[model samples]
Target: MSTAIFRFYEELNDFIAPERRRCEFTCVLARAATAKHMIEALGVPHTEVELVLVNGESVGFERVLDDGDRVAVYPKFESLDVSPLLRVREHPLRVTRFVADAHLGGLARLLRMAGFDTLYDNHFADDEIERLAGVERRIVLTRDRELLKRRTITHGCYVRALKPPQQLREVVDRLDLAGSAQPFTRCLTCNAPLRAIAKADVVERLPPAVREQHTRFSTCDVCRRVYWEGSHWLRMRALLETLGC
Candidate 1:
């Protein structure tokens, strides 16, 4: 059997078993295999890998492995401009849009609150998610590694955090989205952009206290839900502040 040493860097190691994390481990292969297959076999999805180095030279995912090769795999470089290097993806996404799986609804809402174009449907099937990612070029966010492994999903991320708040921080830090946050610009419930509405036009819909206390308001064009700065708004603003967005 052919043997090779594999090393995964940064968050990519999170997918590996505890025994194989953060260090080189030998992998025995029965036949010649592409780097992409081998990497996925070790539990790291190809979508999460930005660069791969074989025996000190950069290689693409389709590179064939040889005996005694040393493979180094890296996660996406959010802060670095490695455009000249060999990367698995053809190009980095120019716009940051996302499609969240069923389990990430809370995180999706948080993303919407930050004014990102996020699409989340708890009823979305795996096939539907894959189709949306391909058609709309939206990044798929999910806690499921296997979902990111789908061949059709070109742009995706394996969310590492559990809590909605922590997940928000993880996504923001990973994508460097802090500067792009436009809080309250989108409908957190429906993922539609919000537009300013005349207070008098929606006065009948507002409660007595809100109608008297607030003048400025925005409405979701899709859901027609009115939003204004109230106690809930203050709480959401505080949450955004804590997230540094």
Candidate 2:
């Protein structure tokens, strides 16, 4: 058996046992266990971990443990650059496309409203989500810890907030999405790009008030739904602005 001192930083502690949270604790490891094995054994998903440090030295998850090792596990760094030390993965997801599980439909719609390409279906199975992550390179966003622990899921986020609005902010803040966000540019219901449609083409379909009050309009090609600058759009714009998108 190997014994080591372990400390989890930031949101990583959410997955660990309550007693071990925000505190350094001793742990026993099996023979020849690597950091990846040890961490997952402790209940923290490997995908949630961004960096691991042993004895003040940055190490990858594959680093084998020693009897006297000291391990510090941290979630993704928000501001401080640890690019030189990142071993779990070298770079962040360049394209932040996401595939949310069954329960996160509200968050998925918010993401779509913020111009993110999001796929959501109440019937999406865990296996399908895992496959999409590997085949399409889409980030898996869900509150399920076990789902994020899958070996095939290399990119993912464990959403913490329960409310849709809070969840949206948490995801945006954690992923640094403000600069990349293209609010109101995508169809929230159909998850397709919104194109500027000629008002004449959709004029007959518009309600009397919409036709009288609004000249700016867009439509979803997939759903053939007309959009206008209305109260709902203003509310969404406000929400995105608060998110710094």
lDDT of each: 0.92, 0.92
Q: Which residue runs does candidate 2 get wrong by more than 4 Å?
A: none
Error of 2 at 57 (Å): 1.8
Taking the tens digit of each residue's C-alpha lDDT, what string does model 1 give over 1-245? 79899999988988999999999999986586999989999999888999999998999888999999999999988778878888887787888999999999999999999999999999999999999999999999999899998988988878988999899999998887889899999999899999999999999999999988999999998989999999988988998898788
Evaluated against the true structure, the overall lDDT of model 2 is: 0.92
The stretch of ten residues in a row with the least summed lDDT in candidate 1 is 28-37
Residues forming the 10-long window of minimal summed lDDT in candidate 2? 83-92
Question: What tens digits encode model 2's per-residue C-alpha lDDT throughout 1-245?
Answer: 66999999999998999999999999998889999889999999988998999998988778999999999999989888887675687566768899999999999999999999999999999999999888888999999999988987999999999999999999999988889999889998989999998889999999998999999899999999988889999999999999899
As a whole number from 0 to 100, the lDDT of residue 141 in candidate 2 is 95
Question: On a 0 to 100 scale, what is the lDDT of residue 187 in model 2?
Answer: 93
| TM-score (C-alpha) between model 2 and the true structure | 0.96
